[model samples]
Target: MNTFERSGKHLAIQSWQKLNSKLFSGFTTREGGNSTMAFHSMNMGFHVNDDPDKVRKNRKLFSEDIGFPVENWIGSKQVHAENIVKVSKEDRGSGSLDFDTAIPDTDGLYTSDENILLTSLYADCVPLYFYAPNDNLIGLAHAGWKGTVAKIGPAMINIWQEKESVDVKSILAAIGPSIGHCCYEVDDRVINEVKVALDGDTVDTVYKKNAAGNYQLNLKKLNEILLLRAGVLPENIIVSDQCTSCQNDVFFSHRKDKGKTGRMMSYIGRKGD
Candidate 1:
């Protein structure tokens, strides 16, 4: 029932209470960093035209606060596709220091390796987290409209089953903060894509037409439904109520900021003993 627990400048996943003590997962806020202007503070994304040094500093602050080293963080180019990559210790620090060095054309990263942090930046898109305690595996995915329609949730599930032989029902999934349906109105183009991606009942359950005739699409619920269809248990899923556009003080919103904004980082990893 609980979404995320706020500590200092970040929000830790409350469901982590049921997991191993070495497991760490959370989403960053827009506060407490060195970036200025549109990036302001805590802009952990280097591709947003923010100063690279400031982005690095912000990343360092977050890593130090979370007890994870910046040097161990792994990133991705995030083309909003369903490309999921399995990371290892050898892939550590990829995209951590810069965007060019990150995994190319990947939106989802999964690994059972300890001390390798999986990270992705977000403004209004969904950040999907998956953990299979039995397998000691963790994964993170960036699900924008394109990625969600591409079925990235199911992609992660498929990867775990194919690569790690994980039972889909045992995976714990969390949908992170993003623009909610209340403020996210989509035109026919996006609505049509969503309608095609989901079933009839699912489309009705996740989308509602407003007075202005535009549809309010619930990205979080859509992703949750996708996870459920992928066999993740209903009780094992946590959906955050926080909307980035509505709570601009605590988070960044690409739409609210008119596409000019910083990005929050969603990260998960297991610490080495």
Candidate 2:
């Protein structure tokens, strides 16, 4: 699977784009918007304490360029849990312009409906995108360590299967830019939760214990494994190698910036109504 490439101000998921022309799916890069200070430019997250006006402006730029209006987009509170929401046309404007109106306590969202974009904010945490062309379904997830251990990857698959009767084999998944194992070292507490998510099975391929007595956790690999465990075919899953902390020049990293930073957004939707 090809990793994301630079497209305009954002890094578009070209591999997925090649898979489906009308499927608008990609993650934003921290360029091409009019913001300053820590945000610099292209900051799309409203709850990151950046000026709301600038965030809106940045979103509008992305909307115009991506051909999806901000009005047709829906965002969420992203509580870093495994909670996933099934979106509808009625939920279009939630969290688009303001965080207060965003879907409450949701870390993942999916929809079979057309023309509505589902979005989630991220810095170093993994960004997950799902598409099932047979049913014309698309989904997005924010998988920080908490959400990953909570099995948010499987949570999305479960919802689509239960609510929409989607076949896991038909679900194509993409893991977007995140903090790679090289930069994401965690203490015992986080690894313990990851162990639980892995059903008490520790795979050495997922992480390596550092000399600091912590572990270098591969979040993207963790998500890929979760999707595979949830029944998505191994060939159906793709992952991006871009690391937020390593490529801080192209993205905002919460850890690289010591927690005072901006965020990028991962979005997916149909091209038109």
Best by lDDT: 1
Query: What is the C-alpha lDDT profile of model 2 across 167-259, one tens digit per residue?
Result: 888998999999999999999898888899999997998989999999999998988998999999998888898999999999999999999
Q: Candidate 2's error at 138, in angstroms? A: 0.6
Clash list (residue pairs), candidate 2: none
Listed per candidate, the RMSD to the true structure in angstroms reads: 1.1, 1.1
Whole-model lDDT values for every prediction: 0.91, 0.90
User: Candidate 1, overall lDDT?
Assistant: 0.91
Error of 2 at 210 (Å): 0.9
